[model samples]
Target: MTASSSAQTPGKKDALAGREDAYNGFLIDLEGLPSSPEALLASLRASEAVWRERAYRGIWLRLPKRLAGSTGAAVEAGFEFHHAEKEYLMLTRWMVEGQPDALPPNASHQVGIGACVVNEHGKILAVRELYGPLRGTGVWKLPTGLVHVGEDITETAEREVLEETGVRARFAGVLGVRQAHNVAFGKSDMFFLVALTPEPGQTELRPQLEELEGACWMDPAELTEQPHFVKRPLFQSMLRACRDWAEGRPAALHQRKITSDDEQRRDLILLRSTGGEDGEL
Candidate 1:
């Protein structure tokens, strides 16, 4: 008999009955399964017989957030936690007795950065994307982009601001962090908020034709009052923080420096202990 034919058992019916030939194993879709530990344990035990009979390669168990309580029972049945998202968790049980090359790969989170630039006039710099989820939706947001490899997060914010809107800005500090799971393209995304101060003598607004349709400096009051901005929690939170900073309230931002292996220390010259010019730390 062929390998596929040999893997099938006769006169046995379980979760693996119909799908045996397709996936070469059983998949316990625990979406609507009972959340009780006892029920989960029973289900896992019943699948073990089919696993041994078929000599299956692997068994997958998907656990939604609602059934999180069944995790212990799954672990007890030799299932290991694999990956998780905001909605569900994935676990795997290897039926084969030998070692495998590597464990199942988990999803990676993508890091993004947004620049929140506020000029001396207390107006916030915003952009309207030429194409995106909010394209032509009258939704104007802060200039944001993904952090490129080997680039500092703060520097990424500065670059994105300049690219989308022709505005030179000095990095002030971080404002906050935002995270979302299973975002566009089934990937988890993270955003870092970088505050910036506009450089002197640069005030013209020029939007990048490729990504942005319009770019301009918006008054903080007008920004908060916009119907579109009111619906987004991120923008609302940023408006509050900007208002506080404008009122002389100190920003709760921490300063950080980007360093690399090839970074060189600044040169220093010292006269004496009593009268010294400078010395590098």
Candidate 2:
């Protein structure tokens, strides 16, 4: 990263060492920051003036919790709270006139995916979690898991089913989606109900003991035997939807190759369908 030309401030060399981003915004480095709030404020003022003179669009700066006391310095320099973390706070300022902020906002949604894996016998694959609210409730649920960063939903669905039930399955397509708020870490969640075909001879029991009490190819009717399972309308609907796909309805889910964040890549797979009833495969 390159610092401003006048960054050599006699004693504090490169006190405002930051580099311009692609959009002409300056991103301040956390290292070599000014020591005290007063010093910080002075450095910020100097940097702001230099950036403005150089036609930089905005400034993005992050301060660790230890230096949170210096937040006043940044605020005094017209920086606004962009977002925050337990360990740090980010502040941003728009230096240009009549243009929108170029930086993207913080992430707000979490995604989870599960698979409805059925065997030739037509029983759905399910698992009983070792600890969550369903531990000993006799409620068998489709093995579901949160999507890891950058993980494809299909990959998450297939992996979760295999990890929880030891069933090798191939991603078929999505069945439906269940959305809820105030879940894990208090974030909103999008749960993708997916359908997977069991790989040949891949049906067996090998429950992951750490996260599951047991796993089985459960008859859909057996779920009703558990009083707790009957009340879960979401799972009930998922069962219905999966059966629809199995019973010769057009696949409700189909994969489309979409462009990834990088403009040059068009191989990211997205699962979509024709509403809830039927879709063209």
Candidate 3:
């Protein structure tokens, strides 16, 4: 992957180099001081028009270095970082205080889970699918699902696993946040890797053929053999999480409102969704 010009800074470069060696690995700790809620909220109002109707894919999209510096009021106000690819980054619109909601409009209200399953040998669990969204469907993927309304994300994972494969398990730590852009879906989703362990006597694991065309268990080494696995965001995220867990690392949790700062303010300013347009704002 080509490193972007901005990633050349000493700090960014060092981090990128370390991440490369790890091969798509990095620790993002979102647990820190929160930003000023009101000032941040106000700024979102003033900048709403600028961020609308733009699909910017990099850090430069947030604000040029000319108008803003490496450190700005935005960063101090709880800036969030989204890793689109190895070198690309996107800053989230809200501070830590009001999160999970800070996501973009298209990205809002999304929740998915990944099982950090491990076997008797202490190796993390993974599955190779003979069918599904992947190219040949012979790809490794973490058993995951979308959280339904009122259902918890964790519960969705467990229920999906049982419904799709019939395995009961528990989760421990978070793997990492995965970002993927799908033209087909016309949206982006963040997948959370969760550490999970099957309950005792729950060893009989197999994909319900009716639900899934085919599925099988695989470890790190075996996972690499099947190239198709890398194509899936969930699988790729799971693999990265497994490797991180193997090395005792934690996935970064950068929570941002799915809505752009401006949209959020617009929502607040207008305070309601009108069925009809108001000509132009």
Candidate 4:
């Protein structure tokens, strides 16, 4: 798969499906994995021999959660744990003699987007979840969700808001971002507070029945009066920041598409703070 080499597939059809990687390595497909541990071990050995003959640099093996019992066979083949996702575990082996492992780290942080829909009248779109940290608390908060694979923050805001509240909103800009550790799936998360303006005449409420207890247009003052918001000064500060965003005191980040003449990094979309004073940017 490297620039100089031809397709380096296995010499014969083995029990496991394998393909070449861009780095002159082999990646074993996770689907149709052998159910029998003995068969899996034999397949790995055959694939390894083929790659070894071609002087491949490394081998990547993925095992689905259902095939976890076959892990011993992969370990016997000299594979070590690289990382794991919600659905599968990744294993790797260095193939070239004396060449150290040179794989990039797997993704470590998840991005979650929250929609803060402020209308012309300044009422915020809010929902009460049937689960999570605020379940049954009767606290009205922004409709939020995790960003899907290959989805941008702007799309995520519109999709989540429409899903949770049936409100088709216009994506304005980003309000803020919050980072916390040891969150969902034992990974760190970056929660975005996205600013949105509800469609002028389409703000009808249709709360998601399964996951949400209620959804409505809430006055900003009403959020401060919720019992859950009363005792926690931190949440209060968060909402206060939202209020500031609605009033246009603190300029939000605006989205801009940037392209470079360099082919390797062209057409990248970036979110820049409205005020250029952010030295960190």
The alpha-carbon RMSD values of the candidates against the true structure, listed in the order shown, are 14.3, 5.6, 21.3, 5.1
Q: Which ranking of candidates, highest lDDT first? A: 4, 2, 1, 3
> Model 1, 135-240: lDDT tens per residue?
8898777788988866667678788888888998977656667888998678899887767888997699889998888998887777677898788787788777
Worst 10 residues of 2 by lDDT: 2-11
lDDT score for candidate 2 against the true structure: 0.76
Q: How far in Å is the alpha carbon of 75 misplaced in model 3?
A: 42
lDDT comparing candidate 3 with the true structure: 0.48
How many pairs of residues collide in model 3? 13
What TM-score fits each model? 0.55, 0.74, 0.45, 0.74
Q: Pairing residues by index, what is the TM-score of model 2?
A: 0.74
Local error of candidate 4 at 162, Å? 1.3
lDDT of 2 by residue, 124-234 (tens): 887888787877776777888889977888888888887787788988777788889988666788988888888899876899999887888777677544677467776
RMSD in angstroms, candidate 2? 5.6
Better model by TM-score, 3 or 4?
A: 4
The lDDT leader among the candidates is 4
Cα lDDT of model 4 by residue, 1-281, tens digit: 22323443466667355667677777776665788888889888877667777677888888888989988999998999988888988898887677678865677789988888888778888899999988877778989999898788888999999999898997776777889999866889998888888887866799999999999887888876788887888678778877876666543677664556575543424456756543434
Local distance difference test values of all predictions, in order: 0.71, 0.76, 0.48, 0.78
Candidate 4 is scored at a TM of 0.74
